[model samples]
Target: MQFKDQLDFVRQHVKKNRMRIFTTILATTMGCAFLIVLASVAFGLQNSLKKEVLSDDTLTRIEVYNDGNKEIEPTEIKKMKNVNAVTMNTLIQTGNLEANIDAYKGSPEVILTDFKENEKANLKLSKGTYPEKADGVVVGYNVAQILLSKEDEKKLEKEKDASKINIGIQESMIGKKITLNWKNEETKKKVTRTFTIEGVGPKPKKEWEQDGTIRISKEHEEALVQDLKTLYGKKLKAEEMIYRTTAVYATDLEAVTAINKALQDEGYATYTVSQQLEEMNLLFLALKAGLIFVGTIAILIASIGIFNTMTMAVTERTREIGVMKAIGASPKLIQRLFVMESAYIGVIGTVIAVIISYIVSFAANYAIPKILYMATNEKEFLTTEIQFSAIPWQLVVIAAAISIGVAILSGWRPARKATKIDVIQALRQD
Candidate 1:
């Protein structure tokens, strides 16, 4: 038979049993939809985690600690292979700076290192410029909020404080001199000093954001450390004194492992995001495997239903099959007609499943983040802006192909049976 004639034969068969075909398609649709939802969720979670943990900072960054009580020298660390930059949080002595502003509730304990060249890469600034003078200090995004008075904080809750909340006004916190009261730890004498705010950093997206921290130049930190020793009348050894923990960022992500190894070899304790990424991958891999296992059960049930339906279809069309055989219709052609009908059912079912899955995915990604952010008023609570269900095109193609293959395979036995019908015997069936 010509291709058109064969297609017409299959088309008529499907149209004649539209109601049964619809039922079969519905079963397959439910199974495919379950698979789509599971796979999309798995992919979405993995994508979100990659962004949150592996953002610009952590991808190339490694935290170095002096677990052996030895001094960590940044200069020495810089000489290591793949080490792009090294910076330490500075310890601001209360002795040098008398007191912070009364409006600022907590004292800042961390300071940004004054590396002339790589400072921009190490941090993201939201406002103003880096501290250039002895009396200037930079603040983190949270620190900016901390600078507000109790009254202002109450106003923020009501969205009433419009002045300071503005971007330009908030950034204008720079150059404002905040008085600090410092008392000598041993002498019990109090002194006062004022420092100007130099810059403000953007809000932290992850734990890596140095929130509630302030930045002073490295020169000022060294000078303050020296003054503290002089006031206490004691010589402090490097081992006894805790300076700061340094973060050594590699040139790129691939270099993090090598640099971490180099740090460990040099007798330093180190932490890297790369190690965390491996653990996360293992966790998601297990989750995906579990989802696939559950999805396979659904598909198996659908396949059985479809196979049973196809078998019954051949029985109902017995006389038709015999008539075709009597007309010299090839058994292969007859078999192919049934298989193609089943495959078409699978294709239609899969298409419907994909459409429904995407509609659900859109609602999930859009609403979840906003709902969480409002509940907690914390950016971290929202995690990354990852879709709750992100179905990639590659996955869609693979799923469609699987559905079609299952349909064809499941119908094979019934198709073969149809081809084997005895012409005279099938023709006499009432």
Candidate 2:
């Protein structure tokens, strides 16, 4: 028989046994849907975690540490391949530097860094530009809010919530010169320096984080150190000259691994967010595979229904099969017809299952967070962007492949039995 003729025959038989065929298709659909929804959990969590990790600016940053034996220098790190920027900072051990602008005064931590390298590191500023001269500096976002007059300080102390006190230097500090003074504890000597407020750093990433440090050029740091030494009558140690912290920034996320490897080879210890993400991906991969394996069990159980349906189809059509054989139809052709019918069932069921799976995925993503938040009363569930279930195109292909393959296998024995029917016995049946 021709392929179209075979399809017509299968269609007529399926129409005659609509209830049985529908039930069989339903079983396959449930199995496929179960598999997809189960595995989607892993995919959802993995994607959510990746997004959270990538959102951080530090994702492309690598922290470089000295191996104790060798010191890490920003200049040497910058020379390495794939390095976009290298930044180093040294914390002055002296007490907090008291900054003054007119009547307002505030004490803030002092950080010394290379301005040229910091510009390449993509330092975000809320207002003004980076320092061009040694005497120019950048103050943290909180500096303006914290710099207060004596009266403002008294008002803040009287308020129950200090955050409610908004009476600080509200005017812009850009292009204004501020006096920074610190006293040498050992020598009991005081030194003061004037610096122009060139820029204001961006706010901290975390809600609870505060950025109040004053960033100054390395030249000022050297001058301050020399003045402190002259007063204290002691020379600084060699290790003290090394930067307290060094970070290397990559051109992009893809270059982080290469840059980290280069730094490691040079005997510098390095850590990157990408490395943590790689490990997370591996774990999720295994979890997803396990979920898929469990889901395939459901498909295998559904295959039993396909096998029984095909067997009954062959038994009921015995006389029909015998007549076809007598008409010179090949056994292989008979087998192909039965297999095609089972495959048709698989294809139809898979299409329906895919639609159902996506609907379920959408519902889960939409409702789960709200449900969790209501149940736990934790605001994070509602605040954070998370997916409880996700379905990708690749998952659909996998489900289709498994469903169709199992359907074909289930029909093989039944198809073989139909081909072996005795023409005489089948024709003799009343």
Candidate 3:
């Protein structure tokens, strides 16, 4: 039969049994609401998980550190089949000191990430290129201030003092002179070296871009070797200060395993990005399941409502069913109609749920973020830049399926009662 006819039939049944209709409607509404809300929360949690667990840097590189108590040898690295390009380095941290050039051996933390001990760390470029010579310096905020003349410091400081003092001495710092001294190296006599500020670099971060600091180019290694030879005046035994290593873009999971094994044999700390992603996946999966589990409880209560409505429907139509049987209605047809009534209840609930869910979802599009921020205390958590995809079409289908299933399950008892109705006995009793 067409839905219009079925709807008319539904109206007749509902008008004759107001309480049953109302109960069914309430139950169906609850079921739909539960499913829709759960879907929305699942999607939101997934997005947050993605942003936090798989930050942008995960796409670019893998980090390796020297966790071994001893040294990582170059020869051991050659044994790894999955290794692509590698940059192994050591950094020795030295404390602050006063120095002079044209009168500027500034005291920015000097990081060495070069082939030679004296070469400067490779700072991320900000305005221009890195320094050319070993002793060429780059400076962050404090170092930049110290290198500037007292009068110039006051002037430049006034010009942009609010900004971090860090600034690089890239190619622009070439030919600029500064005097360098280290308190640690001072003997009874004063020792000093005059180095041209071959370049100034912007400030550098150990693992991120720096706002105020400098970087010296790798080319400074040659100058450093010569400087060290001069300082020692003979053969020198060198020590590695820090080890820097990274993994390449592996095409498969097996490739990650291979790379990790290689780094371990070489005595380096090893890990892959996927391990973190796996944990995130497990967490989000558990959250979704938990929401579903709670929502199932609501649906179960709705099922009870469905059962009561169907049972009452059977009672109200008792005489009508007996008359139909007396008029030669087949048992199969009577059973079909009763089951159809239950399905009808499900369809009504599912449709109303969908319509109302969309209305509420649109409202939530504005409200949820504010609520989440208030709960979490993160003001930036709800930026407009986020892309919230709607509930998938599949979820809509699933919601409908659940409704129909609940209706059928709850209608089974009434269907059986209708089957047992004896026309003679029904007519004689009522």
Candidate 4:
């Protein structure tokens, strides 16, 4: 039979058995809808987690420490392959440095760090720009918060909110001059210098990003280190130089692992977001697999309904099949007719499922956040958005393909049985 004729024949058969077709389509619609929702939830969670974990500069940067017995020089670390830049971060509170915000006494400890001339790209700023010269300082959000005055703190307490106060402090401290007093810890002699606030950094998300730290030019960093050695009256060895943490920027993300491993091989302890990302991916992979598995159960049950419906259609059309065979219609045409009928049911069912899935996805996204907020008045629900369901175009296409394929497979045995119907016996049936 011609392709158009076969399609018409399938349509007529479906029209004649509308009840049976409706039953099969209903099962398919349920199955396909479940599959879309489950898979979408998995994708949504993965996306949300990626934002929370890999959103920082950790992907392209590595933090190395002096945890190893052998200390590494900033110069030696910079010479390593794939190392684009290296910054020595040294803590200044214990290193004969006293910090104050205008006149605020006993200022919080500040971290003294420097940026390489060629490696400014390694720093991720939130509020202001990086310091270009020695007399400029860039502070973190927490550091800015610490600089809040008693009046500011009292206002925050009175209002029972600190978010605005934090923002005020960060905004106001951007151009203020911060005084740093340097002294020989033993001799009690002090030298005071004031540095202008050049920039503000992002509020600390991870623990390491917390400490109130400031960055200066590499030239000034070296000057401070030399001065510290002089105060101690000894020529400090490269290992003996007081360093807190080192920021190592890779040329690219792919280079992070290699450079980190090389540093580890040299007896340095390294921390990078890459390791956390890998772990998170593995966990999400397993969770998605479980969700898909549960969803497939519904599809499988729907496929069985299709199988049963096709079998009954074959039994009812036995006499018609016999007539077609005797009139020179090929068994291949007979088989194709049954398969096409099943595919039509699958297509219609998938269309309905897609529509319903979209409605549910939208409802869930809009409603879940509101429900959670009602239960807990946390601002994170309002601030940090979480999508419970997100359906990507790729997933929609794949689900359509799978639904049609399953329907065709389910009709296979019934199609084969119809092709094998005996003309003589089927024609003699009452």
Candidate 5:
């Protein structure tokens, strides 16, 4: 048959059964829409999970401690295989400085690497030089004013009270004089000295920002902390010990396990982030798969419903099918027309579903952001934007396959029945 003849036959019948056609298309559209939405949402959830896992700073820094001992022996640690350079910094309990700042003594909060030449690596010297001359020091802003001063001047200025100096000396206050005090723990005697503050660091984080506290260079740090340790007769931790080595980064999980054995042989301890990342990654993978699995089931149900509707359509038009065959239309033409109708509905539904999903995504993405702003009571959380609009190609492909294949398959039974219909009986039926 000519293409025009075939087209006219399909269009005329479609209009005659307009009500059924519209209902079938509606169901298909809704099914497609549901699948599209499911796919997009799953993609967003996966991305959000990734952000949460990677945003942590601690994940980047491995925590190394004595495997069996409370404190690792320096010689034992040094001999361990796969060992990176060891660095020591005290990890004291959190406390408020004498000036009233809430702080973690040895945390990155109090760690400073601000000299101009520090980029060449290894905390190098800069203009006005390193803190080595006469006990001068480069310190973080928090504890800058505490050395010789009895009270914080900044605090007093803000409160307008001569006694309350609330602000810790900031980084700009470098090159100022300050007193540091310590005592030998074993001797139970006190020792104190003063020095010129050489450089300052950035303002503390919100959690770290308080009335007063500070970080000092190795020279000043030793003068203040070493004295207390010696007096107390406390040994330094291996992680807290300083060894300048050329190697970079903590060991991987597998390498660490092997190194652990090597360390045992050498009487040293091992450390790596491998164990922690492995555990976290496994959980994340399973979680992502579960979400996608649930989404796929939903899409499948929708596709199946669409297919069933198309099948019913082919059945209802059986009498019309016989008439078309009697009027010089070939059986092949009849089948083609039925299949084409299914394809038409499937295409329309897919297109409409794409548009609908995009609109829903925009509104949902915006609504959550606004709600978060109101709840957090802070501007930072509100401004932390995430890209949630991910078009899942897997979903689109699945929809296309399900819609087309189901439409054709469902029409098969009805189409074959129509072909067997006796023209005389079909026409003679009431």
Candidate 6:
């Protein structure tokens, strides 16, 4: 028979046993759906975690730590291949450095860094531009919030509920001049310097994180050091001006591994977000494999029903098979026809399962977070984007392959039996 004729034959047989075929297909559909939904949990969690990791700035940053004896040189690190920029921070050793703008004041940590290198490292700002002059400075996002007037400070001290105190710098800090005051302990004298606010740093990624720091250019820091030395009439020790943090920015994410390796080989200890993600991916891969394995058991169970249905189909059509063989039908054609019927069931079931799986995934992703929030009363669950179930196209392909492969295998013996039926013996059946 032609391919079209063979398909017609299978369709007629399926229609004749529509109720039985429907029931078998339902079983297969449930099996496939279960497999997809189960494995989808792994896919969803992996995607969520991967997104969170990639969102971090540290993904392309490799933090290099001095191995106690040797300090990391920014110039040497910049010479490394694929290194985009090297940024380092040194804490100002002045005691109790206080920043002031008009009547508002805040005591923020003073860090000295190279603005040119920071710009190359993709330093983000919420407002304004990086410092252009030596006396210009950049303040953290929370600096304005922390800068409270004397009256507001008293209100904060009296108020048991600190949140009730609604007092923070309302005006924009850009272009405003801020005063820095620190006491020279040995000299028992106070020193003051005025610097213009050039920019504000971007908000912290985590809600709990507070960025209340003031970053100054290296020239300004050197000037301050010189002033302190002039007042003390002595030279400051070199170790006292050591860098607190050194981070190497890779040219791109793909370059992080090579740069990190190069730094480690040079005897510098390094940490990268890419390394953490690699470990996390390996863990999730194993979890997905285990879930898929567990799901395959359901498909195997469903295949047993397909096997029985195909066997019964072969038995019931024995007289028809005999008639076909007596006329002109080859044994191979008869076998192929039976196998195609089983495959039809698999394809239809797989298609329906995929649709149902996607619907279920959407419902789970939507409802699970709300349910969790209701149960735990944690507001974060409602706000945070969490995927409880995800159905990727690759997952659908895997499920289809396994379901159809098992379905075809289950019908193999029945098709072989149909081919082996003797024409006379099959025709003699009542």
Cα TM-score per model: 0.80, 0.84, 0.66, 0.82, 0.62, 0.88
lDDT of 3: 0.59
Error of 1 at 116 (Å): 2.2
Q: What are the Cα lDDT values of the candidates?
A: 0.75, 0.86, 0.59, 0.78, 0.53, 0.88
The CA lDDT at 144 in model 6 is 88
Best by lDDT: 6
Give the poorly placed runs of model 5, Cα more than 4 Å off.
Answer: 1-18, 58-65, 69-166, 177-179, 182-226, 233-289, 296-308, 323-336, 373-381, 386-389, 392-395, 398-430
Stretches of candidate 2 exceeding 4 Å from the true structure: 58-60, 92-108, 142-171, 176-194, 203-210, 225-243, 251-256
Clashing pairs in 6: none
Residue 396 miss distance in model 3 (angstroms): 4.6
lDDT of 6 at 141: 92
* Tens digits of lDDT, candidate 3, 1-430: 4557656765787677777776787788778777777775676656655775555434323456556575555455535564443444333232234555453335544434332222222224333334555656554434554454455556566677524454333124446666544343433233244555544443432223343333333454445444544444335533432224433433344677667665666567756666666777788678766776676677667878888888877787788888878988777766767777788778888888888877776777777778889999876657743434346566677777877777878888887888789898777666
User: Model 6 shows how many backbone clashes?
Assistant: 0
Deviation (Å) of 304 in candidate 6: 1.1
lDDT ranking, high to low? 6, 2, 4, 1, 3, 5
| Model 6 regions more than 4 Å off | 92-98, 150-166, 180-194, 219-243
| Residue 98 in candidate 6, Cα distance off native in Å | 4.3
Please give the ranking of all candidate structures by TM-score, highest first, separated by commas. Answer: 6, 2, 4, 1, 3, 5
Q: Give the worst 10-residue stretch by lDDT in candidate 1.
A: 162-171
Q: Candidate 3, 40: how far from true, in Å?
A: 3.3
Task: Give lDDT tens digits, candidate 1, residues 1-430.
Answer: 9989888887898899899999999998888878878878988999888777876456788888878666798899888887878877655533434235544444555554764534634665888777767778776677655555667666777776554563212445767776655556568765445678878777776555557766666766555555555554457643343357688888888888888888888888888888888899999889877886687677778999789889998999999999999999999999999998888788888899889878878888888888988997877656656668888897677677777778788889899999999999999998
Q: Of models 2 and 6, which has the larger TM-score?
A: 6
Q: State in Å the error of residue 211, model 4.
A: 7.3
Q: Give lDDT tens digits, candidate 6, residues 208-271.
A: 6799988988776667776665655457653564347899999898999899988888889988
